[model samples]
Target: MSDWSPLHDAAIHGRLLTLRNLINQGWPVNIITADHVSPLHEACLRGHLSCANVLLSHGAQVNGMTIDWRTPLYNACINGSQECVNLLLQYGATLHPESDLASPIHEAAKRGHVKCIESLAAYGADIDYYISHLGTPLYVACKNQQLDCAKKLLQLGASVDQGKGLDSPLHVVARLFSGELVHLLMDFGANAYAKNAEGKRPVELVPLGSPLFESFLEREGPPSLMQLCRLRIRKCFGIRQHHKICGLLIPEDLKHFILHL
Candidate 1:
């Protein structure tokens, strides 16, 4: 195996001073290893924000992709490095690279990085961006049992019913016997009767006679009037203003109710 270069070593080990010194001495900041990995990718994958900033300052390619098609932003999200993610975004890194598996949002959701999800969303990442292997970010979150990430996506207007084949988000949660996820999805208006490719609704995937199974059957009924009203208000606000609805002049309880605060 080829040894890591000095810049890669500095970046991966979080040695900001050494990295800056190397850059100042006219060392190439964008040098790649045998694996086509850049110093910026190393700093980001390891969550070394200072090393990453120094590398970027020295003119490192912010959107450099590895041989496997992972960008620095994607690496940062995989490691749940919020600071690294923010730094890369500030340096004009592409929010959503056309990658093989998932985008930054998918990486964050699969890893349960709530702050990373929020940062990506704030920077205009496509909330519903889908990967063939992972479905949507929300679908990946539910499949990976990342409740907070899934909830955040729902709040940001990610469709809860999206998925391919036998694995809609609701169907995946049902197979895993996650009652809490089921309730949360239902609260966000998931279609319990929506059939998968195998012609099986989510309830059929649940254990035959458990309380969790019973809950799905109970939830199959139509939503209450209050839920319908909340859904309409949320639809009116849409993704851009759902989080901002609290600032409007409304009843305090209603504000909390609307935002799910």
Candidate 2:
């Protein structure tokens, strides 16, 4: 084993003096452990901000990724360490990196780290970056029922309708019966008429006769004429029917019906 390996061990154990001494003795600050975990990743994971600073000052990669593909920034965001998150960002840490399950913003939002979310956004983190399982940061916040975090993300331009599957932030809020978040999303111009892959709108996702459903109807007002017309067209032509209209085969009859009107 290399002598420099102890620097990561010292960082994990919070032995700042030993870590500093190792650094002073020409130990590379960002040395990785056997598991591909960097000293920076370990120090940040342990909330050893001071030791993290020591590593950062000595040229440790602030955004170093572990064997599991988690960055130090991911650790800070997951642990809700606002100071550490800010420190990492200030020192050139990456807020947006393609990862396995989630992004740093998704981790921060899942845990309702408001400061971390704000910092990441201010640093040009893609507020709309979608993860595989968690969807967008907005969707994760809504799924976890983090209302304040969701609101902050919306204010920062998170797509209120963001999601991949038959889900969206508004739909998740409705499912959780989060009336406040629902109204907040609607007020921010979330597509009230937006549909998921299953063609279900946000309101349709809310349980029938639930308070959230009632509130959704009350706040957004009745569906607009265009919406009502679309529904009528769907009823008349059916959702799956296609017909020739204006010498073109209409793939979606409702679209063709509306266009004809």
Candidate 3:
């Protein structure tokens, strides 16, 4: 590993005073490691918000990418640093997926960082940004067994069926034999009978004697009319307008049900 510079050390340790001194002494705030990892990247990745602020105030590039194409914003989300994420967004970091295989939302979901996911969603990161290896952010959340993050994504209108190829989110969780996750996905409108590229339903992928497999087998047939209606309404709102459901004059219980709160 390349030795981190004094500036990188200051940022990593959250020593804002030392970082400010270096900046004042004309040290380049954007100086990077051999892998092109900058002080800002280190600060954000370490969740050192104050140090990151100092670097950003000194004109550090918020969108600078590492040698492998990960951005500071991506690092912030990977570290679950909501503070750093907000600052990076405020300074104009690109919220969309660039050349990197994983977007900021994808990183947050992969790490089960619900707060970071919320911050990214609040800032308009595409909730459905797909990476072939990781699938959509929702798929990554499920693959990582991030139940809370998966729930949050569903509430934000993430498609529960949009995994890579035909490996629907349900299929992935079922293969893991997580009955809880499978049920949760179903509640969010996942189609239990949906087949993968191999033309197999989630139930068929489970271990032969697993209770999860039996549960999926017993849930045969299509969703009920009421369930289908609710799913359709949820999709109509989608991620961008789901929050508006909160303003309706409906009763709190109804509102909660509609928004999956």
Candidate 4:
């Protein structure tokens, strides 16, 4: 944040009047600190919607990236500012970050910022967008124990088994010993016996007496009849056709059940 001008301070602090005055004096709205932190970046990072509006209206780079590759939209999602997110999107902010480390969708999922995740998905973000280090957004959500995000991703049709390489979301959840997450992923059709690069199953990663271990042990063989039925119905609909299931003439309860709502 070195070499930051008063504009940066005004934006980060939500100082609308001072921000306007600096702009009136012809201060560059797009000026950056040595770290490539722009006033617009500051405004959105702090959820200062008014300051963000002024900067964007005066030609701030909507997609301006920091030295660490963080965008204004990425910053907004990190802060869980749905208002700022909408404002940035209105000005044509790119939903996908160039760097997977700072992807807006995955970042939101990690923090359990369900509204931000919903907005990103509604705007056509790749729900299964994969990063080499972080795996898919669903894996990130599971790794962070963000149950709401994991469910939301599933509702949006994220592939349940697509984790980092062969390490599925179930692996991350089981490693954390979270039985709730384990059941959630299994219900969504995660592979229980999935082997990571080291050939470790999720069950082997947890303590023997742990609830997660018990759950994993009980999951041997094919899923129960009800689970099989659910999986079959979803398979017929497929991932792409999931959204259209709501329009099907099925019973309301059946639709909700199938959608995992």
Candidate 5:
């Protein structure tokens, strides 16, 4: 119950002079409201760049997390406010690791905010940060048909096949019949041959009568039995190959199976 809480609220509502006066009076710059959201979150959400700048200059914690774990940067990216995003970055907001909910990069890419994505990337946000529902930022971009955002993420080192779900970004794009995204993902080294947990390759996920289905049939060619076997083993274990391989391994090509036994 500091005298600054109301001033912080006013900052969130974009009352510039009031916010400046409070900052000048040495008000606590990083105070979170009752909900644990810092004034910075609200200012950025509402695109109040001036108020945000005042808070940042007054020593606000740029990356303060809310009760729900969202940061001011996350809100700015979600709203696709490039100026706010840049200002937050300039003020030293750190991108939190990807969790169950989407990261700021995912939100920016999903919204097709190229500048926001770039700003986040330049600020060291993980371009490939994977999240639930949206998968990687690139995957979300592709799913939303945000080609430019997908391209930017790829350029920033995002993998086209970095998720744990049944579909790679390419698979999702193919399922959505987005030829551009499919091509982009393939060019970025998406393993079209990669299978999801269901034993279905990206090609197999395409609907039977769709143009993507035809394209996949033509481009998929064939996967070797070794590849298929590895895919099956990965699916059986419910683990990604990139994770450490545990237990036993057989030697024979066809008999080379992992044993949890």
Candidate 6:
């Protein structure tokens, strides 16, 4: 799916020795194809750690941009390589994208690469970074049915209700009628009654015979006390502070209760 040159071919195929030989022969580590794709992007995109290491050592542009504005870090995240993500960050790879569609964090979340998402967040990437087309990372995770990515984004304090325009994360997950996703979104403060562009609530999206349909009908009338309490507790702690529940001097069971474990 990537346009490549001879150097790109070597690095992308994990040919560490061949890559080193090419660079030794005065081939530019930063050589770009007509499309501005670098060997580093190719190496990281294929998750060839050693080849990437060689290229970086030879002064490859860590933040090199492709014609579409994709950087090596974004390519690394697309490859789902947490190590490569860390490596580029160490080399000062920018977490922000020149193009919204090229965002490393959104790409990671959309592809269900939870560790890659975590790495990006740990390096100060905006967890709730919203794009004009992709919404937030949480919404992308939800729309793709990537439950783990959605849960991790929530834990890292991504806004659950802030999705593409009127479409909340809840709105996307409800269309799938996935009970697990619905429960996770609810736990993370997604609005059950949130409306989409079509003015349809999440519950309205489910088919009648779907297991989630009657379950929603049963619970939609009144908020459960436990659910209300959970919300209140999270509100008190705010977003990221919720992750600190593990470090609190509370009973283990109480900590689990707070974490919805």
Most lDDT-accurate candidate:
4
Candidate 4 residue lDDT tens string, 98-133: 776689988899899999988887777889999998
Question: Count of backbone clashes for each model?
Answer: 0, 0, 0, 0, 0, 0
Give a tens-digit lDDT track for model 6, residues 1-261.
Answer: 235667888988999888988888988888788889888988899999899888888898888788799999999988899999998898899999677769999899889999998888888888989898989899899999999999888876778799888999888888877789988887666777877889899998999777888767766665777777766776778666777778879789877776766
Candidate 2, superposed: residue stretches over 4 Å from native: 1-5, 100-102, 220-261
Model 2 lowest lDDT segment of ten: 238-247
The list of candidate 5 runs beyond 4 A from truth reads 1-5, 25-27, 97-102, 132-134, 221-261
Task: Report the poorest 10 consecutive residues by lDDT, candidate 4.
Answer: 236-245
lDDT of 4: 0.89
Query: What are the models' TM-scores?
Result: 0.96, 0.76, 0.94, 0.93, 0.73, 0.92
Task: Write down the lDDT that model 3 would get.
Answer: 0.86
Model 1 residue 49 lDDT?
Answer: 89
Q: How much is 22 displaced in model 2, in angstroms?
A: 3.0
**RMSD per prediction, one decimal?**
1.6, 11.9, 1.9, 1.9, 10.5, 2.4
Alpha-carbon runs more than 4 Å astray in model 6: 1-4, 221-225
Q: If ranked by TM-score, best first, what sequence of candidates would result?
A: 1, 3, 4, 6, 2, 5
lDDT of 2 by residue, 1-261 (tens): 243478878988889999989888988876676666888887887778988898898898876776578999998888788788889999998777656454788888888999988888778888888767668888888888898888777655566577656677777777677888887776655666777777877889888898887877776656667656544553454312313233444456745544333
Residue pairs clashing, model 6: none
lDDT of 3 by residue, 11-72 (tens): 98899889999998988999988999999999999999999998998899999988788899
187 in model 4: Cα distance from truth in Å?
Answer: 0.5
- Name the regions of candidate 4 deviating beyond 4 angstroms: 236-243
Which ten residues in a row are the worst by lDDT in model 1? Answer: 159-168
Q: TM-score of model 4 relative to the true fold?
A: 0.93
